[model samples]
Target: MKVLITGKGGQLATELIKVFPNKFDVVALSSHELDIVDAESVERSIAAVKPAIVINAAAYTAVDKAEDNQQRAFDVNYLGCENLAHACKAAGCSLIHVSTDFVFDGKKATPYFVDDVPNPINVYGASKLRGERGITNVLEDAVVIRTAWVYSGTGNNFVKTMLSLMQNKPELSVICDQIGTPTWANGLAQFILHIASKYGEGERQSLVPKPVTYHWTDAGVASWYDFAVAIRDLGIEKGILKQAIPINPIPASQYPLPAERPSFSVLDKTETEGSTGFKTTHWRHQLDKMLDEYTEDSKLSEGKT
Candidate 1:
């Protein structure tokens, strides 16, 4: 199988490349190389590569910046997917788009289901929602997997930010009110590969049904404060951090940002698990695994230097 992955240097895309099986021929491209926002470029790339499947990991993911740069967000998130959908349809290949859980407003206290209606509260979420609609409209068989609170050892995510802050600051404050799961990019990457493999084996009807949207995250939930505290303790245990500092829990109002996040955005993964037969690891376990990997990588880098 020949797979083309966008956002080659991103957290999830990076993990995808690392975990991808050797049986498949993968072509991962960064935005500078592929330029998904350019319709002609996307069409030309797909036509030339002639991939069996195109996994769209590219997205405008700056949550707060999306407020001021709504046009750019829509351009990349909405128009980019639209462009890819058209290109995939013309090229006779499938598309698997990675979406976000922010499509929900977070008004509900429970985990969000795939069938639940999306009512995004911020520009980023709204733009992503538009992208989802665009894919469904253009290609009915396209798979859209919505994930949340993603972090990896390779990128500028919450886990890396917390580790940096804990190393420098005496004490830190994180929002306790906002709640969601912290998904390790490795896990999401595996799930996407599983989907691609299934599709390659001509299991498209079973793997991707109508209303092809699904939710995936590591099991368990945590607020920003909880996530930060876990990072601190794990970082220390893994020798990634020198010591743990006092992490004070604060409400969202205490640290307002340009974007309004969902207070609770836990996604229900029942449908995803049932369909794919893939069990999810808990967020804390995944965090520990990631930290361990980070520590080992740091040790190797130091040895090389």
Candidate 2:
């Protein structure tokens, strides 16, 4: 099987590569190698590789920054996805598009389901919803997987931010009102592969089958404050840190930012778990695993054999 992935250097894309190392003939591209915003460049890359499957991992992920720079975010997140979808259609390849929970307005008391309608309040969510629409509209065999609060072994994410904040501040202030699940990049990446690979089997058949979208993340939900507390607790459990100042919970208003965030952004996993046949780890378990890896990495970097 030949699979091509975008955003070569991102945390989620990097995890997909790590988990599926040498399993398939893989062609990974950074934005520099193939800019998604440029139509001709995207077409050329897709034609050159001729992959059986294409995973759209490249995205405009700077949420707060996007409030100030809407055009660039739309250019990359919306227009870029349109390019990928069109390329997939022209190449006769099945496409898997990564999306975010931000697509919803966070009005529901329950978790967002695959069937739920999206009502985005922010530019970042609006752009991503456009990306989802682009992929689903262009490709009959495409899969759109929406995830939340993704962190990985590579790249900047919430876990690393908490660790850094604890070291510098006497007390860390986090938003306790906004609730969502924190997903390990590996969990979501693997889930995408299982869905993409299976769905591709009948993609080019004589009769087109129904296209599907799925939602996935770690099992449990927590607010940003809860996540930070768990991160610090895990670090202590793993013996990586002797001590750190406790993290404090504050309402969303206490820490104001450019972008507006959803108060509740959890996603339902009924369809995703059913299709993938892989159970997602609880957020707490994932947190421990990440902390352990961080501890090992720190030791290695310090030249500790």
Candidate 3:
């Protein structure tokens, strides 16, 4: 199968390329290489590549920055997706769009299900929601997967930020009230590949009889404080950090940003699990795996030096 992936250098995109099966022909493009926001460029690229499926990993992910730059956010997250959907339709191919858990207002005490109505509380979330709507409106069979708290060894994510802070600072403060599950980009990448393979093999009906949204994240939930604690402990154990530091738990009000985040953005993955026949791993466990990879890579780099 010929697969085209956007946002080639991103955490999720990098993982997708790393874990992709050798049987598939993958064409991964960075934003500079294939600007998704440009409708004409998207159409031309899809026509030239003629991929069997276009997996859109491109997105404007700056949550707080989106508040100040709504136009750029919508151009990338919303219109970029619309362009991809239209281009995919023209090319007679399918689309697999990655979305986010922020679409929910975080009012629900429990997990947000696939069919739950979205009420985004921030510009970033609202833009992503609009992108999701654009995809479904343009293409009937496109797959939309919403994930949360994603991190990988290669990107600027919560895990890396926490690790860096733990090494440099004597203390850190993290929000304890906001809760959600962390998703490893590697795991999410594998799940996406599974869906693409199924679709490419003419097993789309088994996965999705119609257009659907799926929620996927690591199995367990935790607050930012819990996540930071785990990162601190794990970093020390893996020799990624020299010592432990005090991590203080704080409410969101104590440290405010331009964006209003969902207090409880956990997503329910029951349908995704059943459809893909893949079991979800716990967030801490997935973190350990990623740290292991990071540790090994760090050692290799040191050796090279």
Candidate 4:
């Protein structure tokens, strides 16, 4: 079985490779190897590898900055995906496309299901939704997985940012307005690779390598304030920090940003449940597992040996 992955440098791609490095003839390419912005490069790379399965992890993910860089964002996210989808279709290969939940407008109180219409409020979100459309339009055998609030053992993410600020500042202010499910990149990588492998074998008779999509997110919803505070509290309890000061909660209006984020972006996993017959790990469980690596003392003290 052969698998090709774009965005070799991205956080999620890094975790994906780590968890599933042995699963296939893994070809991990970064921007330097195959610039997604250049259709020629994308085509040439795809033609050269012709892997049985392609996992596209590349994207223009800068949220606030995308407001001023719409063209750049669209070029990389939408057009690049178009290139990839077209290439995969030509090769008769399956594609596993990753997407963001920022595509929603955050108007609903409950979780957004797979069938909900995407109404992006920002340039980044719009670009991602456009990319999703591109994949669906171009590829007959594509699996779209939309996820949110992702973090990993490596990378600059919410958890790392919270830990950094907690160490440097006496107190911090985080907006309480935005809420979403946090998905662990490692866990997601495992699930996707399992499907990718089956795709290679042409098994999973009931599942579609064709025009299918699912929402994959960790269990439980959390406001940005809630997530940040939880991290600080856990850090203190685990003795990763000498002390954790108060993390102040502020309204979204009080802390304005360049991008208009969805106040809510929770994704319902009913489709994922039906397909995978498994549920995602809870956010607390995922975070605790990652945090444990930083607290070997806590592990030993708790007699986890």
Candidate 5:
């Protein structure tokens, strides 16, 4: 099966290239190679690749910056998605769009379900929600997988940020009130490949249902402060960090940004679980695995030096 993935160097896209099933002839395109914002470019690229499936991992992901760059965000997030949907429709291929949990306002104390009404609190969220709508509007068999708090062993992410900060500062403060699950890119890549494989076999439509919008995250929820503390503790345990720094828990008000965030963005996976029969590992466990791999890589590099 030929699978074309956008955002080649992104955390999720990188993992998909490295770990996706061997049977797939994956054509991973960087933003420079195939800019989705250009409708003609997308159509041309899709036509040339003639892929069985297009996994759209490309997105405008700067949460705070999207507030000021709404035009760029909409162009990439909303209009870009619409372009991809049209391209897929034209090519007779399926699309698996990676969305976010930010589509919800996070007003509910419980987890956000698939059928729950979306009320994005910021420009980024609104843009992503619009992208989701655009995909479904154009293509009936598109899979919009809404995920949150993605990180990985490679690339810039929350884990890397926390590790760098802890190395430089003796103490750090992180937002404690805001809550969500952290999803590892490797796991998400696997899940996406599974869906793609099913789609290639023409079995996913019966299993996933039409206009599929699924929620995916790690097994447990945590506030930013809690997540940071875990990174600090786990890094030390795995020899990925030299010191255990004190991480202070602070409210979101203490560290205000241009964009307003959803205080509680936990997504429910009941529908996804029922549909795919796929279970995710806990956040802490995933964190440990990533750190372990990081530690191994560091050791090998050091030995080479």
Candidate 6:
């Protein structure tokens, strides 16, 4: 099956491109290749690719910035998804729209389930929720995967930021109140491909269901402070960092941002695991895997030089 992936340069898109070609005819497009917000552009791209599966990974991800850039956020997150859904429908292709855990306000103590009522607390979350609605409204069969706290070897994310900050600063402050699972982009990419494969097999058998939403994250949970401390310790153990960096846990109020975040947004993946018949790696293990990979790649590069 031919697969069309948007947001080529993103962390998840990059991982998808790396793995997709092994199983499918992949057509990956960056923002330069396709402007998802423009209906004409989306239509033309889908028509040209004629993919059996269209994965819309592009999104406006600036959580804090979205507060001041509501229009742009809505344009890209909401309208862009609507356009992609319509294009996929016209092209008779299934869609895999990536969403976020931010859709929920995070007041619940337990992990969020797929059917939980979403009451987004910030503009970014609201826009993403709107995007989810737009896609489902247009294409009921689209698979919408809501993930959280994503990080990868190559990306602007918590892991990368913490590593950099630890190297330069003696002490770093992280919010202890905010909690969620840290999903590895590569792992999430693999899950998406697995779903696509299941969908393909379902074309011939009753293996996969049509147009469902799922929450995926690395198993287990951690606050920002926990994540940073782990990153620091793991970086040192893996030789990614030269020295230990002290991490100070502070409340969210200590460090103010333009946008408010859910205090707890961990997603329950039991249903997703049951559906796929495979369990996801724990977030700590995922972190170790990425850190190990990063270390090996860096050593290999240094050796070549």
| Candidate 1 lDDT (Cα, 0 to 1) | 0.93
lDDT of each: 0.93, 0.86, 0.93, 0.86, 0.92, 0.91
Query: Model 4: runs farther than 4 Å from truth?
Result: 294-305
Model 1 lDDT per residue over 121-157, tens place: 9999999999999998999799999999999988799
For each candidate in turn, the TM-score is: 0.98, 0.95, 0.98, 0.93, 0.97, 0.96
lDDT for 160 in candidate 2 is: 89
Worst-scoring 10-residue span by lDDT in model 2: 199-208
Minimal lDDT window, size 10, model 5: 200-209
Which regions of candidate 3 deviate over 4 angstroms? none
Enumerate residue pairs that collide in model 6. Answer: 141-211
What's model 6's TM-score?
0.96
Which candidate model has the greater TM-score, 1 or 5? 1
Can you write out model 6's per-residue Cα lDDT over 143-209, one digit (the tens) per residue? Answer: 8999999988776998889888999997999999999999999999989988888877864135434
> For residues 52-97, could you state the per-residue lDDT of candidate 5 as single tens digits?
8999999999999999999999999999999999999999998999
Candidate 2 structure quality by residue, lDDT tens digits, 197-268: 564465344322655778889999899989998988887777765686777789999998888998999999
Clashing pairs in 2: none
What C-alpha lDDT, on a 0 to 100 scale, does residue 32 get in candidate 4? 96
Give the C-alpha miss distance for residue 73 in model 2, angstroms: 0.8
lDDT of 3: 0.93
